[model samples]
Target: MSVATAHVDIVAPAVPGAAPGTVVGAAEVLDRSNRRLGRVPLRAEISTPVEIPHEEQCLVHGWSPYLSVQPIVVTGGRTQQALLSARPANGKGSGGEESRRAANGWIRLWGREPDGQWTVRDPSDMATGGATAVSTPMGSPAILQIGGGRRRPVCTLVPEGSLFTLQPTEHRPQGPVEVRPVADSGFTLLESLRLGEWGWATVVERVWWDEPGVRGTPLFDLAVAYLACRRGNLERAGQWRQVAGNRHEDGPAWIDVLAVDAWLARRRGEWRDLASALARLADAGGTPLVAEGLDLLTAELARPPLEPRAPHPGEALRSVLTPYLRASLPSSLTSFTAAHPGVPQPRPPKRARPSESLPFRVERDTSATRIQWRVLSGPPVDSGAYAPVADRTLLPREPGLIISELGELSEWLIVEDEDPMVLWRLSRTLLDEGVATGVSIVPGRNAVAVALPGLQVRPAAALLADLLGQGRVRRLGLSVGGLRQELSVPDAAEAERILAVLLREGHRSSP
Candidate 1:
């Protein structure tokens, strides 16, 4: 199904040039939309509804222009009809360019089957010839029914309950995102259709992302943690997991826990970290079963490793062991252990011998904070036991507080910071003092003097006062992600003053 025909028009077309993927309401059109519009590098505001063909809409790059995705947020934008979807670059809209129809395809709903396959849900209670047959009027922002079409006066299809809803994973660049919502303003767009306005749209009572907001759910954190694990940044994954540990109700979504368990096992003797993780899993949702398996397989860090032994009936194994069916557990640990290898024998931390060429080197990249390992020296002789071979670039899911590795490095490297203060504060906190510290300040967009000043650095916030007070640096602001696999901000002239104050306050002395 073409996106236009499939996804409901999600926005009421009043505000223009608003942020992509944001849901705004009519009441907030002036406040939120206006503030976002001000941030826009361009001035593309056109509040009056303008007609543009679907094919002319620009394709949004990031989680944008979800024009066809429904349960719309009332946002304002030049292409107010579309959200993440944008105007096709080739179009001047009113010019003499030939117009082509946007392609359409089979509309599918978001659902999964029991056997790990995806399937579609029938839009029951929906008239067979409802939305697909009619063109979507971008001007509206409600779930319009054929009978509920044309919000001239809202048809009564809503109070009856929706036939189906889109259930997407949250907080993903490719998935769903929602901004904060306001109190339910008694205001609503009450236009309803009599016969043919089903797709025209009316004001929904509790619109998409407006009532009790998305922040209340753990789905966003789960999705973020999942993505961090996928990227092989265990530090970030662990941090997010900690943030979400209290959300036991959403434990089923930790889809990568097994892989996490495997990697955690490889850490020299991270039995504590591994145990904490498993405990959370048990208490949160998949306890008893998952905990038992992990303890037996990944928990041991003994030398020479304990020989594989058969279980001697479970009833008295431990006080925590509850009676569970054998079928619930894995039949074989041999393959699993061979694939991931149980706990590695303990060794001194990597920083102990900085001069030695190591088997693996973990570092982060500027874009999208990814923690990856590039093989340095070949893998040690027992490399076969480790699931991740030394030759391959490995994105480890959990490296267990690997910051000390960076602290011990004695090399000259440039870690560029879009926000210099974050680079300053974090590196100072995480790295060993005087790890060849130097500060780079770009006080103004047009400022010529880029300085590598020799001063005791401090918390990023203080830099703003020093540099900006001297009328040298631009304004400053701040934010965080884990260092190993995350991202942060600051600027220069004002940056200097901020540094002085921070240093005097003893927050940090070097970066």
Candidate 2:
């Protein structure tokens, strides 16, 4: 009961789910002990001042079934919002626009000001007086934007149930330290919540990225711009096209980017800018996007839409765009394409018994009526066992793959991995209302991949991404069914480094 809430008050829900333009009544908050916490008034903005401990919980309603709070450090850009809401047993929540107001809470954020001191601030406050915020028109519950216009989004929310995603139109913080999260004076938003009158929070380091201008992979933005312009949202289309233009001036993607511009010029009937962006774009001739942009100059939603993972509109366009990327989480929001080429679409684990996919087994202390996960057969993990990874010579594994030494890999890796492809999609349905466990999320090519030891997969949550936000973790949990299976993240910095590796592939902490 030693939570930071101070029991001052309480309230709750997951990513807001109420219909748009429609307001809801008061949402009540209660803890596992059936103790009444507080209430959250509807449509409240961030800055609840609710300090979350390592673990916390609350029950949700409507399409909004539960409230789970975890603070994450993400550099999704200068500004963005994390959506929270209960889905079916599956991570995919109900229909889109169902619960944009699922849960309401101001993410706890820490940033260094010009004065060089790390202090807490609301996510919305991170932006300057004139910064722009962008988001899908019909996305999840998010904090209010500081400055919203045609360019800035008034609602700061993303879709519910996604494999932790990034978009092209969204800001990219790869190489430059100034644009990176927490590296600069700009505050990186951490996850925290306030739904209605109830404020719920958990210890989590959510990762995010952002950008104010239009910049994503060239080809993707061209396609987006073509569709946006045709749909009468020239302002938005121009935004995507601008990103495409910034990406490259002479290439297939660039050619396509310009065709849209030329097409737009014909429509609005103007051109001639500070730089001849049009000249460089049309340099490369007959590109997929260019042809399409010209063809659809006078059409309307002729094709539904295109996403990195979605099925392509035509085989010809597929050549330049490769395969259409399906959104990591399908929802009502418009897709904001980015330039993460090798990243695959997320495929969350299918429903199944834990023993089939897990190296560890579950047991019930019937006497205590408590459930827990334990390693199949192993003494306590040696905390000091993490030494340098024994170097191994590189071997050609396939035409495009090679095996290399585990340079910085920890030596105490999972040795009991019984199955290499086991992925368990934990059920979101909790039988016990008050049970809350601290957990970590990893961004993966496939569905919500939970990181565990010895799993073969690319990193999901970047270990480096966590370094600036909140480092690796501050201890968390996962509730399987209604049973609270507590996983401990040792306080040692080395242990955290190892856990980051394990969670990067998306799994609960190991023994």
Candidate 3:
């Protein structure tokens, strides 16, 4: 049989129930088996109104009740004195006024030496009695010991307001403790679910599932699987989901899990499985999540796979030229083409008949600085010449027949035979003079329309008024398909009135 030995040591209480300013002594006694034996009595001396002074060491006393049973003598060094002072006692109120008041006086002692301050010589150092040996400092007041206890009380003087108070008590060990309101399995599941939503599913599994001595909760594992799927971790999600399904048949309904599975299948390009999964979701009353999955799957299935086509030159040319024409033409033509959708076939130039001869009409404005040319023939024959025209110039004709010309010239010479000489001479004159004067000889209405679609009468009238003054256009004539309208105004005022009439009726100028 082994005899147990008990050992003691000091300790601080773990509980926070002590009153303010209360100081106590604590101890722990252990048996040979290392088990707790019992608490021991410890005496402590607490200074009243415990003061924490700057740059000064304070003295406190601690004792154990077991010390009495197993007597132990503790010894230390010399006594040092610190100066203390007390003020006169105030007589605020007293029924027994005859009682003599203690002297309103003070006490003072020298503070400990700068190097080695006050020290305790013996336990009786704090006894409430006269010192055996002493020589009072000349200017210092006498020191006093007000009380006695198992622990000695040293004599130290203090100011009236600086009296330190002491209250001592014994401490006991607390009983076995436990936390309240243990969490349920569902609560754990919810916590895991929340963490998984925050992209911490793997962390949850490592910390809560695979940890040593950890207990796994079914709902929590399933929740982790669901979050993994949502994060696009399909393989991990499927593994966990399989575990959950195998472990518990009455788990979260398949409908809740099928939507994510379908999405995963689609991502992995498992079209057959994706279709099956989506069908399952739809049969599950097609919840919003399920419906979204089905919609995505449907779109994916409906899309036709890419069938590469060999490149063709004509297609490439059309793609390039189409944008160029649209940009170069006027906004009116561009807008019209956009509004009317088709293959965007170009408008064919008017065709000339083999038997007909179309002549050109040339006229000069009153200033004689501008020239205008028009083709005079019904449609078919009215098709204008495609050859280049010339402007005014000097030419040595046929050795002696010399001709010099100035001012604007019409390059619209109608020839019975296809004569390159006439066309060449005309083109040279037009290029020199017409270009210099910024004049353009337009052949047909189609060319003019293409160049300046905004030249329709209403806009043209506005432009004329802006260029000249208001009502400057006195006469206007336009013909299309042999249907013509001619309007003449006596003055600017009458011209504005007629222009207003035409504008309101949507009868734009026809070329």
Total backbone clashes of model 1?
A: 53
Best-to-worst lDDT order: 3, 2, 1
Give me the runs in candidate 1 sitting further than 4 Å from their true place: 1-89, 92-99, 108-120, 125-219, 226-235, 245-252, 256-511
Query: Where is model 3 more than 4 Å wrong at Cα?
Result: 1-202, 207-218, 248-252, 286-511
lDDT for predicted candidate 3 compared with the true structure: 0.27
Tens digits of per-residue lDDT for model 3 on 1-511?
6433222122222111222211222232322122333332221221222222222212212221111011111111111211111111222235223222111111112222223233222222211111111122222122222111122212322111111211112110111011100112222233334333232233334433343233333333444554555566778766665655444322222443565566567667676666666565444331211122223334433443222252221233234234323422121001111111212223322222212222222221111111112333432221123111222111111111111121211211111112222222322333343322221212211011111222233433333233234333343442222234344533445434444454443323322
All models: lDDT? 0.25, 0.26, 0.27
Q: How does model 1 fare in lDDT?
A: 0.25
Q: If both were scored by TM-score, which would come out higher, candidate 1 or candidate 2?
A: 1
- In Å, residue 168's CA in model 3 sits off its true spot by 48
Judge candidate 1 at residue 26 and give its lDDT: 24
Best by lDDT: 3
Q: Per-residue lDDT for 1-511 in model 2, tens only?
A: 5434422222212222222211122233334333444433322122122222223443212112111222111111211222222222212224222322111111122222333232333433322211111111221211111111112111112221111111111121111001111000001001111121113111110000132232343322443454455456667666655544655444324444555655555445443430143344323222232334434422312333334464423334333222223311121121212221122222322222222121211121111111112233554232221111111111111111111232212222221111111111111111132111211222111111222333322222222123224433333332221222222433345434544444443223321
* RMSD (Å) per prediction: 25.5, 24.8, 54.0
lDDT of 1 at 510: 32
